[model samples]
Target: MAMDADLVTAGVLVIGDEILSGRTKDKNVGFIADYLTQLGIDLKEVRIVADDTDAIVEAVNAMRACWTYLFTTGGIGPTHDDITADSVATAFGVRIDHDPRAVDILTRHYQAGELNEARMRMARVPFGADLIENKVSSAPGFRLENVHVMAGVPSVMQAMMDAIAPTLRTNSALLSETIDTGVGEGLVAEPLRIAQERHPEVVMGSYPYLRDGLFATKLVLRSREQDKLKAACEDIETMLADLKGQRQAQI
Candidate 1:
């Protein structure tokens, strides 16, 4: 398969009480999805679990085993509910210890006042885990086996994603283009399917958006190769143009 044709998959484990209780909307999924999609990594599944050790461990193990890479967000901070590091260690049967590198990263940039025992808890990592660099904040995330543990905050999560994304294998990004058609999806379904068959590698879809009183449709064509995507888009545009002409003639 072409580098662009292969699929690289990942899974996300979101651990928190706020998310499960509906207090937090869990913004990490869309952020990570967009980021990884840009890098050609597909996010296959996402699991949200409360702050429970067994649940965290099971989810960590399961996702790591299933996906090419696994990521966990939340429950790694300084607070009492933070137990991700310990749970991850338990899942991998490793010991969790305070990593000097993490402590050093925190020590250099963060206020010494904030480096108290509670905050120092952030330095802990599973034995043999590799630290993931964080540019936005000094405190680093870490990786054990295929699982990459990251912070929950959107800003910090993005930083960690930037740090780790380059290290993973990625297929070529699926190039996509959209065209606005002031027509309903129902009218274009058959032609769209024909276009899809013409370019078997490209995935095409129509989205209907109701704005004000006008119902408009957007035809989206996506493929890993730029040429294929462009060709598919051109074909879709032509079909839509034909449909418009037919409608005008009918009136």
Candidate 2:
């Protein structure tokens, strides 16, 4: 039997001192959120921890136990600070080994002179982990159980996501419909709240923006079931139309 869409949840763990210390702005959070939403996976929580092994281990343990799926970005490079693989291994009580499949990809891309020890470190995977292909670079990321370890580099991480996304079970794509109201959120909050209560299955949100010295609000209705999203959108539209009619009638 199919279950409710809200029953599934996922989490993301970003591993980097650069992000924690404000040295680097993280771009993967929004990208992963959007990607997971497309797969009908609700991104429930996100944790950004420094490159410390204990921090990474703690986050991996907690998120893995809670969420249906856990994705981690960064700390997978060959540099000294890249310790995510080992940290994950320790967390899972497993061993880290050089994955042959990853090595094969690296070997094909590089000559003997170019294949150095540092680059080979990227091939290491936690015990019983599966390699995630890096289409942009020879170095590969990995997946263990429900946790997916991906690179911090956007291009490489995107390629890894493409390779692994098809293998996982996906629910229905989340559908969202939006309408721009030429009114502030405060003006429409009451009606929107009523609309939301009427369609509890639909996730409704209002984003206010300033455009051309005027305030406007974008009302969005999101849901995994397309029919529910459409129905909710119609209700919201009807309410907004009534509000407009009232204003015109007064004028």
Name the best candidate (by lDDT). 2
Q: What is the TM-score of each candidate against the true structure?
A: 0.85, 0.88
Best model number under TM-score: 2
Which residue pairs show collisions in model 1? none
Error of 2 at 218 (Å): 1.3
lDDT of 1 by residue, 14-66 (tens): 99999999999889998888888888887889999999999998898888878
Cα RMSD (Å) between model 2 and the true structure? 2.8
Note the Cα lDDT for every prediction shown: 0.87, 0.88
lDDT of 2 by residue, 140-235 (tens): 889999999999999888888899888777667778888898888887898899988888888889999999998989998888788878888888
Candidate 2 similarity to native, TM-score: 0.88
lDDT of model 2 at residue 34? 88
lDDT, model 1, position 166: 73
